[model samples]
Target chain A: MKSLLTQPIFSFFVTIGLFYFFKIIYTKYPFALLNPVMLSVITLILYLKSFQIPYEEYFEGAKVISFFLGPAVVALAVPLHEQMVEIKKRKSPLLISVGVASIIGVLAAAGIAHALGASSEVVASIAPKSVTAPIAMGIAQKINGIPSLTTAIVIATGILGAVLGPGFLRLCGIKDPLAFGFAMGSASHGIGTARALEEGELQGSVAGLAMALNGVATATVTPFLIKLFF
Target chain B: MIESLFFLFCFLILGEFISTLLTLPIPGSVIGMVLLTVALEFNIVKAETVKPSSKILLNNLSLLFIPPGVGLMVYFNIINEYFLPIVISYFVSTFAVLYISGIIVQRLDRS
Candidate 1:
């Protein structure tokens, strides 16, 4: 039974099954708090704990899905390419927006964490929370933060950004899809980009662009920002 | 589908190779994104070849995030210790980033 459960294929199915099940719930309710990723993670954690299954065993199986993240991220270029005309039209403002937002995101996270009495490691981890997980984790490691902790923080930030970003934009009376996508992608990374895609293709494309640009900018600037602020 | 997937993998691998060679801080996949975009722009790779695969991947992108997210379990103790600060910081800062960036872009677009 343990061997069966530990098989990579078995892990894949369980993850897919659990994710789809929660995904349906999310679709029906369509609430930010009912985020499919958060729900699925909690359920899987509970499932593993109840079965006395070690996380390592689960991870060994689930890593297959994680492996696709690299390719999936690469796929973002497709949408970005599709929306290139729109992006190129306003290149300067968009670039400035991404660069400024990237800096602000890092500083805000680190500043808030520090003000709240977080340890230096925690502050460092939080600094890259707006970037995608792999790059954020890489940045965290460079700054001596626990990469796993940064991964968790990045995920939480993504979900929260996905959930609140659209609503916040609506409230702020920002209706342009491009701006909407840019904000969501820069703040939330891939998950937020996923949400932006659901709104429309143009939004998705811009979100993908934002996510990629912010990832690059954050990776380039985070180490320096950490030194300056922390 | 297979062909598109093949192109994606090829570009991604090439991106990774280049990133490693350059020792760039950016992830290889992101570099792959740039490469794929360039390929698409110049017609080096047809859009149709990668459209289907890229759509499928991007649509379900959130699902790929779960494995790493589940790693949060490992930090339960540290999180528990710093629960308030961590939670508060995440909540406040996330909203702040969203609000500030969104407004900034919107304002810039208006001008």
Candidate 2:
């Protein structure tokens, strides 16, 4: 039984199964809090802790799943290309706003983390928190931050953004769906874009654009921004 | 499907090769993404060749993060130690970007 728990198939099936299970719950309930990633992570952590299984043992099997993330990131090219085609109409304003927000996302996140007395690594990890998880993981690893920590923070940021993003933008008197989408996508990434989609088609598409552009934009800025202060 | 995987793997490997040669800090995966985008834009790789794999991967993107995310179990102490700062910075940066970007774009559109 001990060896069975350590078996490669054990971790592989557990990770995939738990993820899909919570994914189903999240799909049925569709609450921002029920985010499949968040739910799945929490449940798996508890199970690991309760069973006395080591992270290394579990990771031996799970790493195979992780290997696919690289190619999956390459797959992002499809949506980025699609959105670029759609964004050609009002390109300047869209690009300018996302560009500014992208810079602010890195600067503000890293700067605030530093000022608040987070250690250097924490600051670096938080620097790319505004982008999608895979990109954030990549940036964090490149910059001497903990990639796993960045992933967790990225998820939390996504949940918070999806929940609070649109209403906050509206409170700031944002009436345009495009503006709303851009703000959500730049600040919160994909999950926030999902929230923007809830508002309308225009908001959804633009938010998708914002999410992709913001990924590229934030990736470019994070290395430079962290070097200045760190 | 196999063709799409082939194209994606080619880009991923090419990205790693370039990043190593240049010693750039950007991850090869991101470099791969950018290169793949350029390839698609210039018709170097037809959209249809990658559409199926891209669709499946993008749709299931969140699943890929689980392995890393669960590693959070090891960072509970860091998260606990810096929880206040993390929470504070997250709220400050997230809303600040949202509000400012919204204002800037709306202003840009109006003008």
Candidate 3:
């Protein structure tokens, strides 16, 4: 049984099967903490570690899925296209808000991490944690951070934002759907957008726009921002 | 389907080329995304050419994240050591972005 499961194909099957499996559970429960990414990552890690399987072995099958992340990043252009009318009508405000958030997102995370002595690489990694994983990984590499660690922190940041962002916004008396969406996308990326979609259409599209825009904004700003922290 | 992916890959490669040429801090995938958006806007690449493929990838974007997330296992010790700093920064930064961005957009949007 152990040998059968270690086959490269098993990793592929298990990853996809586990993700959708948790996704189904999320749909049924709709609990923020029950995020599919978090659940799937935890279960897969336990599986790999307990069985003494190396990450490289698991990655062999998984890399095929991972390669799609690149094309998917490009594909994000499509949603930005679909949301153009909304993005255009409110262009300046949307751009301004995302710009400010992008800066704060980096400074706040990296600043706190630095002050607490998270080491050079951790500071750099956490700086781009709020951006989507693909873009965040890229920014991490250029900024002298660990790309893989950035990937994990990016996912964790998304789950944190999805679970808490809405409630936090409401507590602050933010009622507009666009505000909610922009906050979610800029702070949490795609996972936050998924949670935004459950609220309404306006929130969903705006969040998608924010996610794409924040990726660019954060990538552009990080090189400059790290100077302040480092 | 193949056509959509083919066009997307072209843009992806183009993005990497530009990033390398200019020494931009941004990633090739990001540069590619921006180029793709512009191309679609200018009618250089028909929107229909990429829509279907984009849909499938976007729908499973989280799935694409798993392989890397799984790699987090290797860094478990580091994450454990810096747990407090990581947690504090995660909460504080995420909420800061959320509250401030939401308010900024709201006030500026209405005006």
How far in Å is the alpha carbon of A176 misplaced in model 2? Answer: 6.3
Q: Highest DockQ, which number?
A: 1
Tens digits of per-residue lDDT, candidate 2, A44-100, equal: 889889999988888999998878878876776776677665456668888898888
In candidate 2 the C-alpha lDDT for residue B103 amounts to 84
lDDT of 1 by residue, A46-101 (tens): 88888888788889989988888888888988888888898888787778888888
What is the lDDT for A212 in model 3?
77
**Which model is ahead, 2 or 3, in terms of TM-score?**
3
How would you encode candidate 3's per-residue C-alpha lDDT over A7-108 as one tens digit per residue?
Answer: 889999999999999999999998767878888889999999999999899998888988887787788788677777777887888889989999988999
True contacts kept of each: 0.69, 0.68, 0.80
Off by over 4 Å in 1: A1-4
Q: How much is A120 displaced in model 3, in angstroms?
A: 4.4
TM-score for each of the candidates = 0.94, 0.80, 0.88
Ranking by DockQ: 1, 3, 2
DockQ comparisons of all candidates to the true complex: 0.73, 0.55, 0.65
lDDT of 2 at A109: 87
Per-residue error (Å), model 2, residue A227: 6.9
Which candidate should be chosen as best, given TM-score against the real structure?
1
